[model samples]
Target: MRMCDRAGCDQPGNCPAPKSPNSPERWYFCERHAAEYNSNWNYFEGLDKEEASAREQAERAEGASYRQSSWNAWAGPGDGSRSRDELRALEVLELDPDADFDAVRKAWRSKAKLVHPDVRPGDEAAAKEFQKLQVAYEVLRAAEERRTWKGPEGTF
Candidate 1:
């Protein structure tokens, strides 16, 4: 037999668990009291709207930082100063402007892998290189499509 912990309740039964977040180990309340306690409980009761908003923003920023950290961790390292445009231009030249779709795609994939930011996390150079690769791939792909659509000797 146990006593209900709520004040003014003398009924003998199992003591209800405490609903207070502050003293979980020491406090206990009967069913009705616990319900009341829970209804009034507020984790952010004292915070003003601005304060709450600021806290939320801070939390969001922290989350972004953590995500960046994780991304960097996975990416390993960053290239020093290579630019994406330069990489793309080099790739375009290497693949040959006249290369077919398969060749172009293969070249783009190889270049992308070599310069992807994730592959070189902290490297500004890698980021630049990767951008170049993307630009080159896009330009080449568009040109190839246009050439195909034009057909042999401008025929429909």
Candidate 2:
């Protein structure tokens, strides 16, 4: 086990403290020393108001992505599916990302008909494919709604 770097201390150094701002070197310290070091830490000491605010906002946005997701799975910024549901949805409908809603609907209808349970009765694979199409349509529809939704003041 590593010993604390604090002078005259013999405790196990379980916590790591950075030696300097943005430096790779680290100082291992015991819990008490670590707390003492952190108490004097100033993350925005050298930044101006605007710079500090921008950095703080960026950090919050990055960390909040985890909390914003419906589940604790790793999903992209929008449409909280663990997988890349948006791209997968587009692929399912055989449409490109730039395709409009009309194109999405058209493609979905065309492909869906081929796998639809009613058209391919008793075919388990086709039934599964139809389900995929339905899910893809739902994902795209929700995304479109989010893009167009205006809040209480009619502003995004």
Candidate 3:
């Protein structure tokens, strides 16, 4: 069974949270503890108002471009079940939201090959696209792994 990370909280830790901003590591907590942990989060803790605003604007702009692409693949098992980042990753790979891991793998490989730095040597644009594809694949792969994982026992 997956026990909560919080000491003494003998509950199923179904909610997964990042250990820190921009970190791949995670902390598993019960629903209540997860809510409590999130309530106190400060996404821009150290940044000044201007810096925070700038960061927010940059993020919005980046997000807007994705929306502008008119790619909404949420039709099937992934309808509202996937995260925003997952949808974005699907868009990056030109895939449908319900695409299985095998499909994702194929899409990523085919697309990645075209923009791979080695294949498109010295092409800055291709390199940038390649990096984006890499991150997208990583996100989808992690999500798929999470979906297929079955806790030790009594965790459900």
Candidate 4:
């Protein structure tokens, strides 16, 4: 016969373990205390309607951005290899309109490495393509720096 753990409750079998949200630890409460706790608990009492709505919107936007970023990372700049013909390889590899300078440089390096002719040896055409890749990387890199030092829509 285990006694209830709740203070002032000496009755046997009156205390049951209550679930805790923070961790695995459980607290035992008598029936009366449990009801009182439940009644007083308010999950959203501190937040006003506007604050709650803003939080919901921010969460949704963050999810959408994550999904878009993942799709862009996996699809690899639309070089016409797929059914959709929306973006050119250069356009896809170009600095994103919202990207900061560091991100732009990182993206340029990654894409340029893939198309570098030294990687595919023994082909003149591949070398020419590599030259084009180098030019594109340089252009984007310069543009990114200019944009960072200047403002949005700034040209190199």
**Which predicted model would earn the best TM-score?**
2
**Each model's TM-score, in the order given?**
0.36, 0.50, 0.49, 0.31
lDDT (10s digit) by residue, model 3, range 1-156: 899999999999999999989999999999999999999999999999999999999999888755433333223436566789999999999998778889999999999889999898999999999999999999998877665555577221
Clashes of each: 9, 0, 1, 0
lDDT of 2 by residue, 1-156 (tens): 999999999999999999998899999999999999999999999899999999999999898766544333234334444237777898888776566678889989998889989899999999999999999999988876765566688643
For each candidate, the alpha-carbon lDDT, in order, equals 0.60, 0.81, 0.85, 0.57
Displacement of residue 59 (Cα, Å) in model 2 is: 4.7
Candidates in descending TM-score order? 2, 3, 1, 4
The runs of at least 3 residues in candidate 4 whose Cα sits more than 4 Å from the true structure, single-residue gaps closed, are 1-95, 149-156
**How well does candidate 2 match the true structure, expressed as C-alpha RMSD?**
11.8
What is candidate 1's lDDT per residue for 1-156, written digit by digit as tens? 566666688765344554445655644556666667667766567899999889888888878865544323332212322234434554554854234567668877987888788888999988987777777777655544543464458543
In candidate 3, stretches whose alpha carbon ends up further than 4 angstroms from where it belongs are 1-76, 153-156
Report per-prediction Cα RMSD to one decimal.
21.8, 11.8, 19.2, 16.6
Clashing pairs in 2: none
Q: Lowest summed lDDT over 10 consecutive residues: which window, candidate 4?
A: 80-89
Task: Output the better candidate (1/3) by lDDT.
Answer: 3
Candidate 3's TM-score reads 0.49
Candidate 4 per-residue C-alpha lDDT over 5-113 given as tens digits, one digit per residue, 9 for 90 to 100 = 6677876635555465456655666677767767876655679999888988888887986554433443333332221211232455664444444665677678667
Relative to the true structure, candidate 2 reaches a TM of 0.50
lDDT of 1 at 75: 29
